[model samples]
Target: MIDWLNSTALTVFGVGTTWAEVLGFVTGLLNVWLLIRQHVLNWPLGILNVLLLMVVFGTAGLYADMGLQVVYVILGLYGWWAWLYGGAGRSELVVRTTTRAEWLGLAVAGVLLTGGLWLFLDRMTGSTVPLADALTTALSLLATYGQTRKLVESWWLWIAGDLIYIPLYGYKDLWLTAILYVAFLTLCVLGLRAWRKAIG
Candidate 1:
């Protein structure tokens, strides 16, 4: 039984999938688990997950995603510091709702950024599903920034991005990643509820 189970594990994490992505998914799960509890340690673990993803995306030639990993690194650092010293008296950041103007800005920015990235990828790079990919990618960036600031609206953006991302990753032949995004979608919903309750 042990041998058989080991073989199955090997096959699942075999030739197509690398150890880095597996580790990445594990760290991502851990990060989210901590995040749900509003733990500061989540930021560091999240950074580790992004680092692993950076390697995975680079190997897959998903340039936009690979580049996003770099951005994640910077954001992770900022988030770490901000969460540590971005509240009253420079304390931990807390959840906040988007103001009317912020909502308008996020909507307009999400659309404009998505359109711009689509054009850039479609015209400049030989990207498959360039428009769809770019749109999700751009919005995810906005979402990530929002999350760092502990904004409740980040959950909504994540939901939208992950909804599109699951299919995109699947279409890209990244089966494991597609699965990860599915989990992310669920967590986004949970995070929203959790943050709302905390804020209220």
Candidate 2:
């Protein structure tokens, strides 16, 4: 079993890509788990996740995703501060539902942005599955924004995007990242359950 494990690790490393994918995966899980508990630590762990992923995705030629990692770092910093003090009278952020208008706006924006990102990725780059990959990437951005604001509906967006991401990452031959997203999907469900109970 040890030899088999060593062989697998060697094969993965022989591909000449960074092994930070595994590290980012573990930290990403920690980040989301903290998110479910409404802990501020999630943001710092999330920052680490994105910082590591920026390297992993950049090496894999996922430029849009690489850029998303950079954006996530910025948002993670903002989110860290916001969750700490952006609430009523500088209190902790509270879970809140999006308004109907906000929900509708997000839906429309997801569709438009998905299409736009797909076109941009396809026309501008040599990325594989640019359309599908970009669609998931775009929606995930909106979802992440909603999460940082403590929106109760963010889990829904995360679930949707992560569902799409599983196959996309699988297609990209990042089995570890694909599995990480599958775990993310499960956490999204748990996040929904936890946040709903906490908010009420």
Weakest lDDT window of 10 consecutive positions for candidate 2? 1-10
Top model by lDDT, which number?
2
TM-score of each: 0.89, 0.90
Per-residue alpha-carbon lDDT of candidate 2 for residues 1-200, written as tens digits (9 for 90 to 100) = 22222232323423422357777788999999999999999999999898887777776778789888888998899899999999999988899989999888888888888888888889998888887778878777888889889998899989988988898877777778888999999999999999889878
Cα lDDT tens digits, model 1, 46-109, are 8889888777776666777878888888998898899899999998888999888888888888
**Candidate 2 error regions (>4 Å):** 1-17
Overall lDDT per candidate, in order of appearance: 0.81, 0.84
Instruction: Report the CA-based lDDT of candidate 2 relative to the real structure.
Output: 0.84
Global CA lDDT of candidate 1, please? 0.81
